[model samples]
Target chain A: MALLSLSAVTLTFAGNTVLNEVSFNVAERSVTSLIGPNGAGKTSLFNSITGFYKPQQGSIRFDGTELLKLKPHQVTKAGIARTFQNVRLFREMTVLENVMSGAHCRTSAGAFAAILRTPAQRREEEEIRARARQHLEFVGVWAEQGRIATTLAYGHQRRVEIARALATEPKLLLLDEPAAGLNPTEKHDLVQLIRRIRDEMGIAVLLIEHDMGLVMQISENISVLDHGEIIAEGTPKQIQSDHTVIEAYLGRDDGEAFLDE
Target chain B: MALTDIVLQQLVNGLVLGSFYALVALGYTMVFGVVKLLNFAHGEVYMVGGFAGFIVLSLVSGTLGSGWSGVAVSMVLAMIGVGFLGVLIQKIAYQPMLSAPRLSILITALAVSLVLQNAVLGLTGGRYVPFGADLGFGGVNLGNLFISYNQFILVGTAGVLMLSLELFISRTQYGRAMRAVSIDKDMCRLMGIDVNRVIAVTFFLGSGLAAAAGTMAGAYYGSLWYFMGFLIGLKAFTAAVIGGIGSIPGAMLGGLILGLLESFGTQIPGIGSAWKDVFSFSILILVLVFKPTGLLGRSEQERM
Candidate 1:
């Protein structure tokens, strides 16, 4: 059974359709990639799934919960966590604090508990700190946890963002353009990290990427989106050979040469 | 009196006044930090808090003997009441307008302020209500300086409140969430944080601090008026700006500095006490011109 299923999800902004009847399913523990050219509504789909953009028509179900009815935070609580296309770490917070904030959903301490410093609250805080540190270490940014998040190198900031997302303990992770601005080394490390997140942590990943090499290497299944519609869904080999996907990407019939490269 | 003694006395006075400003300024800074809105109704919340404290005091003084304990009880109750009021105001007035233009929300804040002021005016017939309790009657005299019990209570309470707030922001789960939301609201949501709840809590803390300041101000000044929140609110805002509008420590420092400036500026041979406000506002203008980000405020470039 699918861990996440989106059926006929439609989103419109100011009477202009942004996403039109987009339907796909991410299987449990599977690595899936959504690939499309620019302005193909991949991020918009992610936003809808995360409850930032409420789709006008559709059902989004994750683990039997209707995510369409939930708010963004509720969606995160419901076991779907995502990193933005652009790194969005809290600029004012230290790297450790940034990841610790992700544990906020699982922790139940409120303002009063904190003000009074109850024993349970203290224990929970220690646990949260430990969990955050563990994720930071997993992402290989544990040494930079004391520095301000935005002050780090761009690649380190991206890793911190992923660790922060991982700290949420989501059943499924959505990474949008994770390799967008990385050097080759960072990209390779990110691929390894994504595999570790799925293989070791038992989390499924749904990625949106323009890097065909990364997508072909990492994704078990691929869904091709163009003009807000999914034109093809299959293995990376099938997508690379699909005439519609090739046409969508190269806007010509000779795109098979491009896909082979 | 010797010049040294006079300066010392003014220093004490300024510290007392600065405490109140810092307390209220915390509210401005915290609210702005999270929401990036200049909550004009904040001062009215402070004014309402003064009235709330006054009412609580009136009700409990007969049983509690009108002592420091009674004042403490009143302040606590007032903090809670005004904190809820602040939350309600945010939910009803500000939350809906979160997506609206900045000008519209600001105007709405002004409207809320007017509503609060008029409501109080109508209820009390626009009269100056005497605070009735004289908490400052006694004092400790040291050398040429005399510090009243009221000053002690004011400074002591404000100090404790500010310290508690600092701890709350730095160490608590909700506090960290508040900081995160301030930086990036959408990212906080992705972290499974209820941004609305964080904002509501921000309003609660900010309003509560202002309320504590209000209750103390009422006791110190011995009077409460419908218009009391106006000037002080502006001054607290000035303090927030001076300290950096989104910075908690900056607000505290700004408030103390503004208070000291007011205190010392009043003693400038020809200026006299009448021009004290002139000095306060002049400092504000100078800060705006010279250090627009205030003493502790980070530059936009640095923050970005």
Candidate 2:
């Protein structure tokens, strides 16, 4: 069974249809890239899956449980975590605080216990902190943990955002333009990080990226979107060779220019 | 009163007044820390606390002894009661507007404030009633320095509560979560925190503290009215701003400073006593122009 499956998912924002009968499945421990042009509603679909935007019509099932009825935090508790297209970190807090916050949902300590610092709460906090630090190390920002998140370099902030998301201990991780503003070297590092997160952590990775190079390099399978519909779906090599996919990318003048480049 | 006596008395009075300001200011700071908006109705919540204390004290007068224990019962009951009211306000007034404009929430806060105040006015006939002066414990007498028990309790309670709050924020996971949410709501949500719950918790704690101040005010000074929250609320708010808006310790330091300023402000021969508010607000303007971060706040860079 798919780890996360969206069935005929449709989203309309204020009468403007953003996702029209979009459907896909993210298999466990696999990397699936959702690629689309700027207006193709990639983020909208991600939002729908993550429970940020309730779809007008469709069903999102995670590990066989209906996801639409659950709140965003409940979905997180169900082990689905996501990053935003625009990075959102608790900028004023230290890197460690930002990442540890992701562990909040899974934390077993009740408010009273956490407030009173019972032995159990202390042990749980210690475990969560250790896990948070490990995630930071995994993302290569552990050394920068003391720094305020906003003060970090762009690439480091990106790493921190991913680390924060990873702290949730999700079974399926959604990456929204994770490599958008990275340099080539940072992109290579992020690609490695994504793969390690998948292979070592045994988590399925669902990514939405405009960077075709990064997407093709890391994704096990690819789905192309245009005008809120799935235009193409196949393995990376198949997606790279499809005629309609080529037309979707190169038929428009901008697409042709992109192809030329 | 002689100049020395008037000066000394106002200094004493202002410090006592500042304790109330500091107590109420903490709530505003905590709420603003997490939500980034002043809980405009916080003052009304403070008033509600006073009423809760009044009602509880009336009920417990004969059953509880008339000394410190009675007062203690009243304080605890008042805090719990007003804290509940705070939670209700969050659920009814602020929650719906969480995603709305900051201005809308602020207006809703003002509306709640108005509604509570008028409701009290309707019940109490807009008159000030004296509370039990017996809540005042005996005073320590220094030669010419007359310190009342009420003053001691007011300042001491505020101090202990503040220290506890500091320890709570620095040492606990919920505190850490609050700090995180204050810094970034979306990040907190993504972290698996129920952002709404954190927001509610913030209001509960903050309003609870404000209730403590309200009860102390009624007990220490012996009278309270429906509009009692307005001036006090403004001063506490000013204190919050004078300290960095969201910083906890900053609010305490700012409250004490404002107290001292008001205490000393009237002493200037020409400046006179009436200019206390003018002086306090002037300091706010100066701080805004110069540091902008207030006394302890660090300047934050914009996140793109």
Candidate 3:
């Protein structure tokens, strides 16, 4: 069953159409990829899903829940969490703190409870710390938890961002260009991590990527977008063969010659 | 008085005065950090806190009893009252103009300050209300120095409050949300944290602290006037800027530094006790010219 469904979503900015009648879905626990060259409106799609931007016309349903009715935080409350293309991990905060902040929605402690340090609040806090640590360990950032987020190496920051997003305990995780700034080895690690995330945690994963190699290797399904439209979608083998996708990536002639190997 | 006693006396007084400035400055810094607004009326919130404390102390002591217990109870009530006032102001005044130009919002804050002052003046008939000392609420002599039980409450409660605020922001879940929201409100929303509530709660905590400090200041100074918070508010704001506008510990440190400078500066022959405000602003100028980021402030990113 589709965990997230975008029906005829349209978005426009400054009278220029960014996303026009776009639609797609990720089934339960499936890894779906949205790939396109620059200006394909991929990030705009994520923005719309996360409630950062509202679409002019469309229905966004998540597991039978209407998403448009909710606010951004409500989007996370409705089981949708995301990372940014350029990592936005509370820069001055320690890695552990950044991840622990993600657990905010799951807990309901007020300012007085915190100031007074009531027994219930204490227990909840311990739980939050333990869970935050576990997410950090899962992302292989436990050792770097004490370091400030912005100080970490590019690859490490990306993993910490994932851990923070995971701390939200979402049913559908949206990763925008997760492998954007990684070296080849880090990319390899991320590929395995993404697979484990779905296989172990049983959460649906939807990603926006420009890395065709990473997308094709890990995605169970791929959707190709260009000029604000989903040009084609299929299994990796089918997408790799589709002339439409080839044309979108490489102009008119399909550029079959470039991938002949 | 012996030189040692005079020096010690000034030191103690400095800490007490600094405590109030620190408390009020924390409110300024916290509000500015989140909303990026100066909230010129924050001093008025402190003023309302003093009046609330005065009314509560008067009524509670009249019926229940007097002394330290009465003072403590009044401060608690005042903190709560002024805290809600802060929230209401945020919701009605600041929140609406959040997207508006920053200048207009600052002007609104000034307007709020004027309105609160006049309203209190009209209500109290523009006369100063005298607060009477109870049992130990009055000052005690320490050799050549004068220290009030009100000072104990003022300095001590401020100390406890500052310590607790530090711990709360560093340890608790809600506290973490505040820090994170301060860093990035947009990302906080993506993390499923309600930005608006975080802001409202920030105002709650900040205003509550200011109110508590204002009440203490009223008791220590022995008179409550309609315009009392005006000068203190500006000084406290200066304290926040000197300590790095958006920093928590910096606000506290800034308060202490300002108080100490003012207290000691009064002793210098060339600079009379009346030059305290000049002394305070001098530190602000020095810090701005040299450090720019203030004592513990991490970034130049925080709004001026």
Best by lDDT: 1
lDDT of 1 by residue, A1-261 (tens): 999999999999999898999999999999999988788899999999999899999899999999999999999999999998789888868999999999999998787788778999999999999999999999999999899998999999999999999999999999999998999999999999999999999999999987788999999999988899999999978987788887887864434444765
Candidate 1, residues B1-304, lDDT tens digits: the string is 8899889988988898788889889999999989889999899999999999999999999998567888899999999999999999999999999999999999999999999999999999999999867564789888878888878778888888888888888887888999998888888889999999999999999999999988888888889999999999999999999998999999999999989888988889999999988888888899999999989998876333
Better of 2 and 3 by DockQ: 3
Task: Residues B1-304, candidate 3: write the lDDT tens digits.
Answer: 8998889888988999899899999999998888889989999999989999889998899765766778788999999888999999999989999999999999999999999999999999989998653645467887888886666767888999999999988999888898888888999999999999989989998899988987887777787899999998988998999999989999999999998888988998899988878888888899999998889887755423
lDDT for A91 in candidate 2 is 66
TM-score of each: 0.97, 0.91, 0.97
Chain A in model 1: its TM-score?
0.96
Per-residue CA lDDT of model 3 for A1-261, tens digit only, reads 689998899988989899989988889999999988788899999999999999898989998998977899999988989998999889789999999999999997777888799999999999999999999999998999999999999999999999999999999999999998899999999999999999999988999987778888999999888888999989989998888877776763334432552
**lDDT-best of 2 and 3:** 3
Per-residue lDDT for A1-261 in model 2, tens only?
888888888888888989999888889999999987678898888777777888978899999899988878888889988887777887667899888888889887776676456899888878888998999999888999999898999889888888888888899999999998889999999999999999999999999987778888899889998889998998988987787777777756457543542
Question: Which of the two, 1 or 2, has more DockQ?
Answer: 1
TM-score of 2: 0.91
Expressed as tens digits, the lDDT of each residue in B57-96 for candidate 2 is: 7778888854667777898889877887898988998888
